[model samples]
Target: MGSTMIEKILARSSGSDSVSAGDIVFARPHRILSHDNSAAILGIFEKLGGKKVWASDRIFIALDHAVPPPDEKKAKNHTMIREFVARQGIRHFYEGGTGICHQVLPEYGHVKPGVVIFGSDSHTTTHGAFGAAGIPIGRTETASVWALGETWLKVPESFRIELSGEAPRGVVAKDIILYIIGKVSADGATYKAVEFHGAGVENMDISGRMTICNMAAEMGAKAGMVPFDKVTEEWLSGAGVKEYDPLYPDDDALYEKKMEIDLAGITPQVARPHKVDNVVPVSELEETVIDVALLGTCTNGRLEDLRQAVEILDGRRIKSGVRLLVYPASRKEMQQADKEGLIGKLLQSGAQIAVPACGPCLGAYGGVLAPGENCISTANRNFKGRMGCREDTGVYLASPATVAASALEGRIVSPYI
Candidate 1:
């Protein structure tokens, strides 16, 4: 039997000819990612007697979670991180305003195909879009990597998700993934690697693929991946990646489970408040009122996402009572949107554009809702109190287009409508 992508990557990383799903190997990752939590990781590193990182050049840090430091406590944390970076001679550190770590890492050419990347954030899986095995590690684990330069990973069983048929009009990758998660439920793929393939995936762009993989964690997946292909190559090349040998699973690779989805008939989908798997068609919930609409995050804050929202809100204002917040994922993305006048159009539509940051995605700052309020957000996760507001506030997840259309109508409505 052939090895799956995860198996192959693990085998190479561990210098083994072959590895299987339950095999544990100590692998040295090509890159280690950490963000605002670096402060905490630094604390752990100190406790481990870590005077210096195993490899400063291999580590990437970004201050994104609370870009401007919403409070003095966070500001002091940033101060400590800055001092640590300077003392450690870390070359790839990105300060606030650089953008979310997930987006920044790829934009800076730190992520490459067939490489292993470990990050301190759950959305670390987002890097899998480039055909790398991006896994999330806890702060202490990250600290261990800093001290020892390697960590162990038990190769995960693979779940093959084959997507057939082209995505229908108005249905984006977010909708397709949401539908799958709804079917599988939140814990369906626990500790398994979800490998995507087939027509629907092939037809998706890097942004869409990133969106799908970013949310795989919500389904309890250890990682999510799309095979490297011309699309992946084109994206990397554009990002200044000169040469890379992409990796893919063999045609007969063994998989623990397999599933297929046909997207030709799939419509816009929404994950209602409090549960990401509580998905339903937008048409079924069009009458639900919303008090806020958020149009950016690591999940859907790329240029394409902004364009989708722009198409829907170009010359019209959002509903009178609704507040719209838009944020670009990275400084570069924000610049591109500004160059194309998307920001101006969004502002014309009564949308408030915030700095490039995580914003209210983690309830840290930026568009928190009040008790009894309802919000439709492009950010992943709608769990209770996720927006840093009253637990009574409801958060709904959807594609940027769906969010924009809903914002215009002040209620849950399909972009197709």
Candidate 2:
């Protein structure tokens, strides 16, 4: 009888008392986000006869996908976006070097509990880690939001996923989510909202929660959320969020499906080349060679991730044949890592620390693999051609620890060893 978190958020956003799955409502989002693709959205907006955005203040723009511009065309796109931002008076614009849009927006406190956000990137669902609803929208839909200030969404059915036991040593949030996705398959939760809770989730920090939420997109989920608890409150408060009305689903809220996972026995997991759901335990794979080891992205590019990598690589160097690339998610994160000497440790370990951006993750630019080469990355997806070389090169997805461990051996290996 009670409403789920997604339902409650939708109800409030639409000025309704209650909403149910399948109910369509026009909701005004707390924020609308766009990144490198904003250039295309701008063109579409103008085509739709849009002169000014409905809410300039609530619109956020960032240049991240093609940082530094891989070519003259991308550079020109950034130029157009810059001109658009200036002319539209959009105050929340972040230029290249600021970081990936997903990481940049939340780090700046743009995401808050109980609010709804729509981002043009699929990974935009990463914001749900803050107990808010972050939905991914297409470019044209984003253009519509820019012109009309509102968009329609069908309240998705809810999936109640309760995590019961603590994760095993050396197993991080990425491993746990990968295990779940392997069980459910890629399309198992299509168009559903997954709400995470229980002892394990309660024990997770914001970074861990963010990792889980970030991968929910791989499960075909509309959104992934953790209830706003003390951890959420503490993170918000630390970010200078003084006021927010956190929302949670009632105990009796209806769920379309439910699952309980005990992480006590879970171990380090990996998603092999070509598909995120093609997952297996790190121990299952044969010792495979790696040409590149990437240590950052929106998924696992936080300070904690860098520190973990530092712990593993401090006294040693990555294999001579392997190229290790470390990219911090944001300028602030990069600065903090530098202040703590983590960056120096990585550099000393023979790792190349790139600027704060989404480099090499989408393979749009930076660190593209050569023919027959493969990379071990802390990124979310591992689909073929995702790393800019589909014909021969491949990508493997794992946690930061595993990435560091494999970098040392120049092969796929578990960090626990």
Candidate 3:
């Protein structure tokens, strides 16, 4: 039987024969990434009679969620995490001011193809963009891996998505993904692996791949992946990947479903409030006004995304009543944008720059939405009350282009025009 891409990678890592979907595999992870959300899991594990981590340095910890902690309790949690990381001897400790775990993992070479990565974060699916098997496990499972150095995985069925036609102007990978989420529903791809392929995917840049893969969890997917190619090789090479090999699914590999997407006439899309699956074209929601226009997150806070925003908002001031918040994904990204004058342009255009954390996205440390306020953001997830509002404040998920356009119009608008 021909092995799927995931099976091949896992088999190699586990030192086993060819494995198939539906089979259970026990494999050592290439990386185990966790953030403050699960850092407390370590303490819980200790309370549950597990003392030391099996391998200290294998764990990667990021203090992003409560970064620059919003209150005293959150600050104590950050302090506890620092003490835990120090006690565990974790070398990849990213203190406050570092980027989100998902964004920094790949950039720092902690995520690569042909390897298994387990994260305590649900969005760890973001690492699959590099052709790696990245899955989010619950706290107990994460702690067990920390103690045992390995974990069991039930192979997931595969879903193949092949894109052929070009995405229309102002449309982005986020739109295509949201469209898929709407079609597939929230749990449509549950316990399944999604593989992105075809010429349209190939035409997309690295950041676009990250954008698609980052939202795989929205479908209740086990993971989402793209085949490693020259682009992957180049990205890995630049990040000091010296002796890595790319892997792909065999021609005869099995998939439970296949979807062919033609983005030829697709317009910029938005995920309406309280549900990521509530997708609509920008033209359909032109009358919806917004109070906040936020541009940045682990999902769409890359350099290219910032550049796109700057290109659209270069000389135009943000519309009255619109408070545009610009946040770079990382300190490096902020510095680069400043050097390139994009930050200056944004500030001059009435955009308030927020610090580089998972701010405003997860409602942890920065920027909480109030009832009756409306925001158009590039961040992932639009669940009701997600941004710290009990009354279900409105949040429209969009790309940088759409966000910049909406900031300039104070309402949903098409950037293509």
- Say which prediction, candidate 1 or candidate 2, comes out ahead on lDDT: 1
Compare the candidates by lDDT and give the number of the best one.
1
Model 2 misplacement above 4 A: none
Clashing pairs in 2: none
What is the full ranking by TM-score, best candidate first?
A: 2, 1, 3
| TM-score of candidate 3 relative to the true fold | 0.97
- Preferred candidate (lDDT higher): 1 or 3: 1
Which residue pairs come into collision in candidate 1?
363-388
lDDT for predicted candidate 1 compared with the true structure: 0.92
User: lDDT tens digits, residues 1-417, model 3?
Assistant: 576777887787777877788889888888888887655787777877778888887888877777678788888888888888888787888877777888778777787788888989888888888989888898888888888889888877899998889887767888888888878888889998899999988888888898888898889988889999888888888878767776899898888999998888678888898888888887787589899888998888888898899888868999998899876787777888899988889898998987777888877646788888889999888988788885858999998998999899889887878
C-alpha TM-scores of all predictions: 0.98, 0.99, 0.97
- The TM-score, computed over Cα atoms with residue i paired to residue i, of candidate 2 is 0.99
Which ten-residue region of model 3 has the weakest summed lDDT?
36-45
Alpha carbon lDDT at 272, candidate 3: 92
